[model samples]
Target: MATIKAIVEKSALAGPRSIKISDEATFSLPAGDVFLPAEAAARVMQAYGQAVNEKVLVGMVFPARDEGGWGAVLSFAKEGYVRDDDAQNWKADDLLHRMRVLQAQSNPVRKSHGVPELDVEGWAQPPTYDTTMHRVMWATISHKQGEPDDDAHRYVNYETVALGRDGHLLLGVASHLAAFNQSKIIADGLLADIDFDNGKHYADFDKTTDHVAEYGLAALVVGVAAKKLGLLAVFLAFVAKFAKIGVALPFAAAAIRRRFKKRVPARPVAAVTTDRQEPR
Candidate 1:
């Protein structure tokens, strides 16, 4: 088994928010406050991956090395209250299904562009980090082609959703597809180490004063209320588009030559001159 070292730091999000991450990875912060308004947050997130309509409180990317190929990225977003219907019976499987559907829709687009699609090979909900505070869900994706050869070559993503005491919904997503099992350990550790100020945790919810959300846990996964795609879809689409272009350009050039042959006009031959008087 591998050992991990934890470092607690001020969250890139707003006040009273802090996070913990493994010391092995280097963290990158957005230029400004990550908790920008919905539109601003969406734009900022796009710079990292894709536009997410939700109000992002903070976004951080942990690159395994200074050179940046693979590592872990995390984001915290705010959703309105949880709906009564969904809160009662929502399960991690529901989120997994939603993710699968999104993958199916996005995969073909990626392949068409020549980028390999990541397949969701497995998923499971580990024991909750804090049963009274949040519900956790996780899934693993197939490794990208050409990734470093390693025993733990796989991609894993985790989402922790909780209802804040103020009747607000909070979501935390950790995406790690490159650093093998190292990222997995980091993600789990981060969740376990999360510390929210008083009146912020789910256990602080007040039934009398707090308002109920129109949607529930299911809504968080499927976005029933917003009826819009989540950040994962947007991020995947962005990656596919760029990856396909990079991967296909060379092959596309070759294919183009086969389809349309450009005839180079034959150059006129220069008259030949002989050093001897041409034997005339």
Candidate 2:
């Protein structure tokens, strides 16, 4: 659809560019990547789901030969400094159950919007927190209800959280099931590219003065599965995989007024590319 192209066109950067990830960190996006600022990034998110209050930034499109490019969205949650002591006792089985409950609760809203309900089948990659990097990344394999659990209809929601003294940077990488592993490598690389400012590092959290998020890292996972980013992820899953085969994504949000009907052909959206070719 021209809709997808028009929204995504005109924003490709000839990078090695520095992007401000909220007010907390700097993202050194590799060369030839597109960077969508917070406001522009939020508009893209709103197109797929409900209104969002989170600070959105760094939308990059990776070209995939001819299948069209898949991309990722970055959001920042300033929920104060999050304490990660629970990582030692993290129980992913329990966390997965909680995510499923949240998904069920959101099904009604999904149905109302003409979006098919999707269930969390399981982790494409289990939740892992890096003690040294102070970041967490996970991926969920979700499929449309009643559909066979196959890559053709599978949606991989790969998410990464980079903790900071003030809050955390959220990266939700959307990709086709077949592209999950490659996308994970890219997401991990992007995570490594982020850096906190002088005093904003997670190590700089001062229990005496800094704010601590009421919820732990586990709660962050559950909240993301049911809220703003969750809805965006679902639509993106459709946009990423369905669009690969040229199916038109339904645009149904009252929040989106600028319409695009043009479909941008897929191109290489890898983190770095020497060539600066536009999408076909």
Candidate 3:
């Protein structure tokens, strides 16, 4: 098994409210509280972009390929993670190893089979990266809030595409989803599959206890969009209309009359009013 080691440090540009997840480390920090190593952060963000792109592509209005490519990728990823040998069949792990060997051997003849590289630009964190990191962080919060089994939702590592010549990873731009469907992660750690090695497995390993953090940041984005759309619709619908107390007064009065009826006597209401006005 190829071991992956990753480390996270602190960055001034990354705010205290900033959260980051990478192939090496997952970060949840207050401004200036923590920093993640640049490479690992880029790798994680890249993978995250790919993952989000996959979800979006599968759900696209006009999908590129109709031959169950999404299912094929998922099955392939799962198989590589579990399988042991090539005689049994081919797998992602096998491919990853072969690629690593090619990288190590420096065979320009087989350059096409080498490992993929990632390039992240300055900003623009993708929703998946944010969501995955928040999930881990919130899972921790939920644990603190006394939720059980909240630690089984963590993500260790994932696969993502390499940026172009600039080596920039832009979470905001639409990427080629077909590429992601072909890429795969070497290995991953899920919250449900937590087995602490302290320092035995990879470089970024830590002794901290795991937790399940659920962050519905995407829902928040959707909520904000819905609210904005609603506000825009209302504004457009009522645009160019003159403000009038004439229209507002009747509606306000009706509301007040309803409140008054709730407090008035149910029976003989007219008689009570007549008696009150009986020259008293």
Candidate 4:
């Protein structure tokens, strides 16, 4: 029977993160195997390591407390694998898959089972994404290590919400599991790092946690501003909801031209003779 294996890579920067695999290969023949390619793995692994490291480092720096960090992370990650400026942005789905595969090879139990464990030998192809939003990944790794029931694994799941056309907020929730689901990893250890919240606005700290709390708080804060400022915020919000068409929005039936009210040049009236003679 095939067994699961996991592997980790050594790097100075961000990784030592592993990928996991659940099965073994049938046989080894030519060097150019479809699934297992030797020469390409080194490049793929480097890219994968960089992707994971950046994701984690950015989160740590921003810290996701008041939505500033979370929002930044979302904006950075979801802007396509390559940006308009032509910089490469690693797609989340591709990175997630690579991590899973790499970890599988490093599982440590493959030797005892006599199965062909790939380990984190390396990666062949770069990651590609199907879509930018609505992604979920789950992987489980079990290692006895001569300890009683030493089954340990981790879960990293998150979703991003785009607000209007301008901004986005990301909510990345991660949890670790050891010995089945008997314990809560977030509450016990990871709690301090994340500072998880049920989504409350700072201005309305007194209010109870409820649906749309952030929205309500924003509205309330805007309401407190002087009338002109408050109105501007409300108008900006409204404008963002619609598609940007031209210099002026075509919202109402009256199509007010952005340039001059009327383009027709004024007719030059006959100049009245300033020095009008006594008798015309």
RMSD of 1: 23.9
Question: In candidate 4, what are the lDDT values of residues 111-218, reduced to their tens digit?
Answer: 444322322211111211122221111122222233343223121122212121111222222222221121121111121122212321122223243222233212
Q: How well is each residue in 1-280 modelled by candidate 3, as lDDT tens digits?
A: 0111122112112323323222222222222111233343333333322222222121111011111111111100100011111212222233233333433343232234332222111111121222111111100000111223322311111222111111111111111222221211101111211121223222222326322122222222222222111111111111112121112111233442342233321111111000111110
Best by lDDT: 2
Ranking by TM-score: 2, 1, 4, 3
Expressed as tens digits, the lDDT of each residue in 95-147 for candidate 2 is 77788888888788877876678787777766777777777777777777877
Report lDDT per candidate. Answer: 0.38, 0.63, 0.20, 0.21
Per-residue error for 40 in candidate 4, Å, reads: 34
In angstroms, the error of model 3 at 263 is: 48
Better of 1 and 3 by TM-score: 1
Off by over 4 Å in 3: 1-11, 14-93, 96-155, 168-280
By lDDT, the better pick of 1 and 4 is: 1
Error of 4 at 265 (Å): 65
What ranking emerges by lDDT with the best candidate at the front? 2, 1, 4, 3
Superior by lDDT: candidate 2 or candidate 3 = 2
